[model samples]
Target chain A: MTIATATMTSKQRMLAALDGRLPDRLPVTTHHLMPYFLDKYMNGITDQAFFDYFDMDAYVWTVPHRHDPSQGEYPDPEQGEIGFLESRRVSTDDWRVYWEKLPGYEYQTVRYRFVTPKGTLSMVIQSNEHTAWVAEYLIKNKRDIDLLGEYMTAPKCDVEAVNRTAEEFGERGLVRGHICCFDVFGQPGCWQDAACLMKVEDLIYATYDDPEWVHELLKILQRRKMIYIQSLQGARFDIHELGGGSASSTVISPKIFEKFVAPYDKELIAAAHHAGQRITYHTCGGMMPLLELIADMGPDAMETFTPPGMGADVNLAEAKRRIGDRVCMIGGFDQFHYLIDCAPEDTRAEVRRCFEEAGANGRYILSPSDHFFDADPELIRAFADEARRCSYR
Target chain B: MTDLEDLRQSIIEGDMKSTTSLVESALADGLEPGTILNDGMIAAMTEVGRRFEEGEYFVPEMLIAARAMQAGLKILKPKLVDSGTKPLGTVAIGTVKGDLHDIGKSLVAMMLEGAGFEIMDLGVDVPPEKFVEAIRGGAQVIAMSALLTTTMPNMRATVEAVKQAGLRDQSVIVIGGAPVTQAYANEIGADAYAPDASAAVRVTRSLIS
Candidate 1:
């Protein structure tokens, strides 16, 4: 461990860690600032204010999508100010949306209907205060997939909008975005995206019942993502997120991952590198089995290394030993247990433990395994203050 | 291979078409319906569970195998009914209210059904009243699932509802999901906690037996 003579900015510290070099101190950050947590715990503070309050490294997320008017693509009429975390909606005339309120449910149910000349497809989504989930899947019938391949609008990167935000958010934190996925419910990985469209269980059954159709659906999704990647050529993003919790070992098998997750993501990562962007494979669950395989994808970083206590099998020290040389590792702290309803000193101890195990190699960022809807504000303060004390000297 | 052995092999391979056809042929040969179910579908699912525990199989494999077993069961159901065969136990399962995530709950329901337990799926965002209603409807076990920590309190509420309705001794309460743990189960006074779908089967069996 080497001590630094001068302090570094939050951006400088994070960039150094991403580059596999030591910074002035260990870089500490949280996975996501959930809106529920902000309202309930932080008195509705802005994400930047929360970061400033904790004195930790911050991150800004933005996804600017461009629509092609020649294809009849237009901005969604119902899109609100905070549209899926700074993402703009673009859809074709054939794509229509409808909403309904159930008699007993707390959330509003939405239907995104895609009408094609061949056929029509629709997906049902339910949204509450925190986030939304798929109520009825998009690809209800086998033929609906054909409708999607034909009529779904392909959204491009709004390079000018992204550049404007990048300029406005200069040096405040890292600029992060994700590779395009299917609208409403999707994953960056091809098979995972298909699993979202078609139910995961049915897609898995189809792997044996109709393997060719499975491959074809994946190819269709992969092509759309490729077009999205092509438009990312001049975007000034520090790190672009790929992968999702669906690709985690806790959800699928290593055999499935090798056959489905790796092939598509590997190519996407290569293309992202060619576009002068960094990639982080975000797996919010068990990753012990696929560590080497994910590293082989050649992403600059891997995240949400959920610890064992949080229903995952991550052994942070062992993970650091195995693949720490290949890519920067993020997340391992058990926020569910230590971040609330525990002693502040205990929270500090867990932070120290994570730093001792994963932070030894200078390329580790201490973060919660994943998002947390509820937390003790004081413990969050302790988490950051303790991390500040974990200086490498 | 014997017809039963072929049936088991087909199911393990997740060959739904072959498994269903084999079940039809075995019935045509006058094999006992109970024997076919025990020696064929159940035996194959046991192997699938073992392979899943050993890491050779995953959710997709388990789902395919479960579908194959369902296909075979579809053929064996009428015969089993004619012979007065009964399921081992009855379990009512649902995702607790305020949590709409159903993949985990669905998997557990399927696994329990595959393990020979009769399942009454109440679907997602099910309230405590639903659990009580299922218990009143002669469910032997109440299995509740919640994927979010925010919704976990509903598990305790369901447990309280059962006790309040004077049905605690008649029904065993089991809870599980991504954020659920044995400690949380204990804290909430649940009878048992299962970490995964396979474990849910074993735990429910133990509670009933």
Candidate 2:
């Protein structure tokens, strides 16, 4: 194997891998660092410093969005801080958001209402100190999709704001964002967003029972996401993520994925490419069956190659052999076992195993499959230090 | 197809409309409710579980099949009660404290019910006391689920609560979800661990036997 001669920055390494080119070393980073882990383990370190602390390459998450006032869209009056994969909620008079705290049985539950000119759609969300989930989905009735299509405002990309951060973050990390989803509760991809609106079980059943309605729902969601994609023409995102766990093969069958998931997301990936942005389809569950199918959708990368121990099916070497040459591979480390409650020797060996397997080639980033709620700081440090030593030289 | 054959086929294919109609027709034909349940809907669920284990069906297919079983059961439940057909056992199920995920747990509950177990769905974010209460209420099994690693420890806490409540020996504790494993179940002193909804029935049955 030829070693890369030039040493590069984290940003350079990530960009190199994204293009399926060799970097100086295996690019090592992680998916989202959970706040619970950070606060409990690392004394609440800043996200950037958490990467720097381990001396591994960092990934800076940024998605700046603006309002198209000409379309009568302004920032929602009641919305607070924008969060991960979230654009600022753009509200028009016809469509407004109002949330009220509800007494939950054990956690904090809140109901968000979308007051639209046509009608109001409400969803309930519940959360604890660690994370949140949809207690009640927004689309209660079949006709709710029509209300969203007619009244919901699309959030636009704040191109200048995103580029400004990218300029300042030069050589530090890659800028990332995602396509907007359904209002109140949703994920990036069409079927996934639909899953959040309704239930994944219902969505899957809809594919078999009422496929035409499923298609209509997907079309409505894809239309809103298309507006966001069109607005991303000049944003400097290194990669935008699509897909969620609901689309994972672990959750649905290959037949369902091909019929309900692929058709909509493949078009979005193509649109994203046309808008000059790289797309990475993130499936954080059993991916063994869908690797080739996902690669066929034309994403620049695919990620979170979880292993069987984490309740997903991924054989790193097999995955690398299948799609490694086509797209950059990200996240194969079994963090649940190796990142905590294991000897440092075992942790280093895992890092080496990933390097020897998927990382032997140029386009693999060593990362955990997904967010971990708890981990030993020393093991995390060992994880990063060992990865940096996996140099191409 | 004959009424019984159509009843089995509709449920296996997850065709709820056909399943309910065939079940109604079978009842109209004077078939016993228990016969329709055990030989028809429940038999289809057993095949559904087998197909899930063999990878011929996935979560969606299994869930859809479970929905069909439930619909047919809804029609047969009254007749079964009138005839005094007993269930397999009673199971107390919940999603544990601090975790709110419901789908996987609900599937397991449905699958158990399809297998003829009476389910006490304790709902999400259930505390240890609630599980203990369910056990005191004569639940033969305790099934818990947690989607996040943060909430997984609640399984251990719930087990300990059962032990402390002096109901541990009488209850079979089973655990599962995205991050759950056999090792985790063993570590938490749970009676069994099910990797998926299909395995849950097998494990629960093995433990009960």
Q: If you superpose only chain B onto the true chain B, what TM-score does each candidate give? A: 0.96, 0.97
TM-score of each: 0.95, 0.96
Off by over 4 Å in 1: A1-6, A69-73, A77-80, A92-105, A117-119
- On residues B1-209, what C-alpha lDDT tens digit does candidate 1 reach at each position? 24788998898888889999999999988889999988888888888888888878777778878888888898898899999889988899999988987778888887787788889999999999999999999899999998788889999999999999999999999999878899999998999999888888888888888
Which regions of candidate 2 are displaced past 4 Å? A1-6, A83-85, A103-105, B1-3
Chain A TM-score of each candidate structure, as shown: 0.94, 0.97
Looking at model 1, residue A32 earns an lDDT score of 76
Task: Give a tens-digit lDDT track for model 1, residues A257-357.
Answer: 88777988899899889988899899987798899999999999999889877888899999999999989998999999998899999999999999999
**Lowest-sum lDDT 10-residue window in model 1 chain B:** B55-64
Q: Report lDDT per candidate.
A: 0.84, 0.88
Writing each residue's lDDT as its tens digit, candidate 2 over A1-393 gives 233444899999988999988888888898988877889988988889898888878877776768888988889889897764456788999999999998735678889999988789999987777877898888788888888889888888899998998898888888877778765667888888888888787788788888999999999888888888988998888898898878887788888889888999999999999999999999988798899999999999999899888889899999999999999999999998999999998988999899888986688989999888888989988888788778876
- The interface root-mean-square deviation of each model, in the order shown, is 1.3, 1.2
Tell how far residue A71 is off in model 2, in angstroms: 1.5
